[model samples]
Target: MDEKRLIEQKIFNDTSTYNDIMNVPYHQSKRHLPMNQLDRAFQFAPFGALEGFNDLIQEKTELYERKKYTTSETELTIERQLKYLQAHSLKVDVNYFNDESGYYEHFKGYLKSLDWKKGRADFDELSVAILNIRSIKLIKK
Candidate 1:
């Protein structure tokens, strides 16, 4: 196994050790610690907060992984399609291209004009359509 994989596996297998490493004295000492009853409350407060933050991080990591996989697949599909299009001397839609500011402004206008639910549905549909088109073109080639 690779070093990164090995380290991740170790962390997973020994969660206590991972927690201990993360909770090193120097790090803990840097934080503000309360006194008496307030200390207990503060300590428990951070535990709950940290748990919530960890959950959010895990969720974001999963999302990032999914997006990365999708992006890589889409890029490969687009590259294959471009090659095929070149070979066949087919014209590509130039309307897809827009300057960064123009694209952002379009979306900003879209957000301002549409209802939240409708805009979200449209976004999902467009995303799926783009991915499907690229995937299909790649498979065809």
Candidate 2:
């Protein structure tokens, strides 16, 4: 009836079973696993518990977003700055927006050419859309 007695009786009943199991000597497995500590750890590692959840959070919490539209005054300012860039043709840091992701990103380098036809400013191995241009400031060397 008491918890102590109940446990004592159960232990007494299982004593033979425990003795049978304990009587045997510990035996090594015939085939040994080749798993290292790192591999064993990897097996229990957390994996894709919420796949794409982190990416979704990152997208929502992005540092910058593209403007809905550029103002007329801002457009004029950019045009003047671009002209200066063309005349000087100096290595500059360009801040621009990505149309696809609607996020602002920047790079520092020399312009390969200003592609007016394609509406993209081309750099060595990189190009950004003209419409997405935010600000271009000359990087003084």
After TM-score superposition, what is the CA distance of residue 136 in candidate 1 from its true location, in Å? 10
lDDT against the true structure, each candidate: 0.40, 0.75
Evaluated against the true structure, the overall lDDT of model 1 is: 0.40
Error of 1 at 75 (Å): 0.4
In angstroms, give how far residue 64 of model 2 lies from its true place: 11
Query: Which candidate wins on lDDT?
Result: 2
- Counting clashing residue pairs in each candidate, in order, gives 0, 0
TM-score of predicted model 1? 0.22
Best prediction by TM-score: 2
Model 1, runs deviating above 4 Å: 1-70, 94-97, 100-141
Model 1 lDDT per residue over 19-67, tens place: 7578666545557663679767877785565657877777656544423
**In candidate 2, how many Å is residue 22 off?**
93
- Give the range where candidate 2 is weakest over 10 consecutive residues by summed lDDT: 60-69
lDDT of 2 by residue, 8-87 (tens): 99987767657767778877677996678987887787883677899977875563443556788877887777666777
